[model samples]
Target: MTSLQHVSTISAPLPAPSRQPFALALSILLTAGLTGYLFNAQDSHASLVLLLGAALGITLYHASFGFTTAWRTFITTGRGKAIRAQMLMLAVAVCLFFPALSAGELFGQPVNGFVRPLSVSVLFGAFIFGIGMQIGNGCASGNLYHAGGGQLRAIPSMIGFAAGALWATRDYEWWTTQPSLAPVGLIDMMGVVPAIILNLLVFAAIAGLTRHLEKRRHGELERDDNGSDQPWSRRLLSGPWPFIWGAVALAVLNFATLALIGRPWAVALGYPLWGAKAAEAMNLGLDVDFWGYWLMPGRDTALMGGILEDSASLMNIGVILGALMAATLAGRFSLSWKMPVLQWLAAIIGGLMLGYGATIAFGCNIGAYFGGIASGSLHGWLWLVAAFAGSFVGTWLRPLFGFSRT
Candidate 1:
């Protein structure tokens, strides 16, 4: 193809010049601010570790998705380098959380207050979440990242997501009031260490099996014109390690947030809040009732409830800033909007599902799946299974609706 043709075909939307710089600076400022906030607010060292793990997870996620070269290489070669990074993240989380179980503390604080959901509830929520993410074309975190990257489709998806979350929040009281719903915790398990070991074993077995299958099928395929032969080491270092480090840093920040804030980190609550606010503005009068009764609880309301109920919103904003900063610095900001109509609809539906499911599950991919698994909660694993099953079903059905796999 000619140079002009190539450029035209690959062109994506670019963030405004002023917004680009603002996004970068804002990201840095938020990281610093949140970190300081967490340190001052939390008391647990384990919570600090969790915050660090979360940061690492976000960084790796960005590196895996935002970097076109790395992503392309992985796609061409079918390598697990990115997946390995995720696995390592889970490993670190498992290691850190298991010990906290035995000690009955997270970062040296009591863990009794953190609530867990029943397996059945988690599974049901996961199924809904899976379908939502499939339709939405991204999960909670995924939406923020894509939006920051200038995907216009994400805008509508997020709107739908907020609407769904608002609906769920309005109905949260009735849902939690159900007899089948009860707060659960991992302390009732055989302690954290055993749980960690078991999880590690399972992860190892799965990794080994996956590796074996890839080797058998591809026979160490070399990089071809299809861009498959990139060295693993090169791929690992191609993107900014600082970005990855930033994600790890976010994890540490989250731990501090939990200790200080008395709740795990999250990023979906904001959607619901926005939904509620919008409804209120429209004279629906949903905000006062929803915020007063279901969202806020206890006499120390301002100090405690605000932090837990609003953590997801804060995190969601941070994610957008973070991704924007990463993209701008790398000169990768694009405003491209070329998705088909079907994909757009899918994204909207997915966002709605994610909002509703996350509220019911009491978390999203980050809170329920990642945090739950890290805490050695069985519910986290169950969510993963259900979500994955849903993802597979979504993938299979996508062709029927003209959504192609990336």
Candidate 2:
């Protein structure tokens, strides 16, 4: 997500430009190579998931879809265009997810929602994650797409995310013991139709509130209606797509993920595993031997397996490659390695918070908030409130790290 200082206001459309042929070629090669490797080594499903991830990356990049930026802009500027877009995305997702989830299967494959317990762990973790994302300048999904889009700054943030996730593993069991309510799904409490209706009402209320605030503060709503003047074919391939398009694409892609993987799309779950893999390669301590998370049956196998074998990891790679391809196609794949000391420090600290918070909270914005709410999990609502509060504080703290509030 672009920082407040970097936020684009309404402007005349730019002409379409040529693609970065070398970068585009490289991205395509990497994506195709990984897809083929996953297909041959794992199965057709793995390859499909990877492609889905790439598509998500492309959508996110083209649309500039972002959580951190959306929240920050709302807090600092009262512009809720992106926030409204998020509400739209979630609304669409629930409309698609609720019925399929209630049925217990899709196309003969068992499927489940991301319903998780509501707990103090979630409150604290999500709160810190909010702060971290503000300083780190990217949420989990933001980190992947930004890194893939050739933002070199995200590299340190991602590195810190991995380390923080690994560090959280040392105390995962204790956090789980924090006071909590059992997992509660709105669909379980009410029927699917009722749950959907209730969720839609809440989404409408939020969107309406944003509009009211923007009207009061700015005297007019900021429109997300800007894009290139190119033909449809060119715009589809190289884009600054309208916000609604991004929202719909994300919602549909998430639905596709559920049908393929039996679970909603997620990103943070793969970070610790990646960290552990690096640690193992460097002769660091084996987390599987000590960390309770890695000791679990499913996680243990994932830890022991090939890097590309894990769906989450593979999907993460796809997101990066996809973003690369998107940026290259749009002729905007520049990478810069310049940064001040304090900003760099902020990135590291923020990333640590993002990883640690997501680990304890049971998910980042994508998994816990987006997936959870769409699945009718009460925890998602809790995550949204807590993370938003944390983001408020984070927005204020940005100035300390050389970031402007507005």
Best by TM-score: 2
Judging by lDDT against the true structure, name the best candidate: 2
Error of 2 at 133 (Å): 0.4
- Tens-digit per-residue lDDT, 1-406, candidate 1: 0001112112233223355676557655766666566656764342344344334334533353322222222333555443334455566666655565456566556642234766454666677777666656667766676566555567777888888877776566666666464544554565666666777787777656556655766886322121124343432322234223433444455454455545555666567666765676689764445343244654224223443234455456556655555555434456767777787777677778878877777677777766776666666767777876666566555565465533
Q: List the residue pairs that clash in candidate 2.
A: none
- TM accuracy, model 2: 0.96
| Candidate 2 per-residue C-alpha lDDT over 1-406 given as tens digits, one digit per residue, 9 for 90 to 100 | 5562132222355434454788888899999998898788778999998999999999988888888888998998899999999999999999999999999998888999999999999999999999999998888888888888888788888999998988888789899888999999999899999999999999999999999999999999987764645566766788778889889999999999899999999899899898888898899765445778888877888888877888888788889988899888878787866888998998999999999999889899999999999899999999999999999999999999998775
Error of 1 at 189 (Å): 2.2
Separate clash counts for every candidate: 31, 0
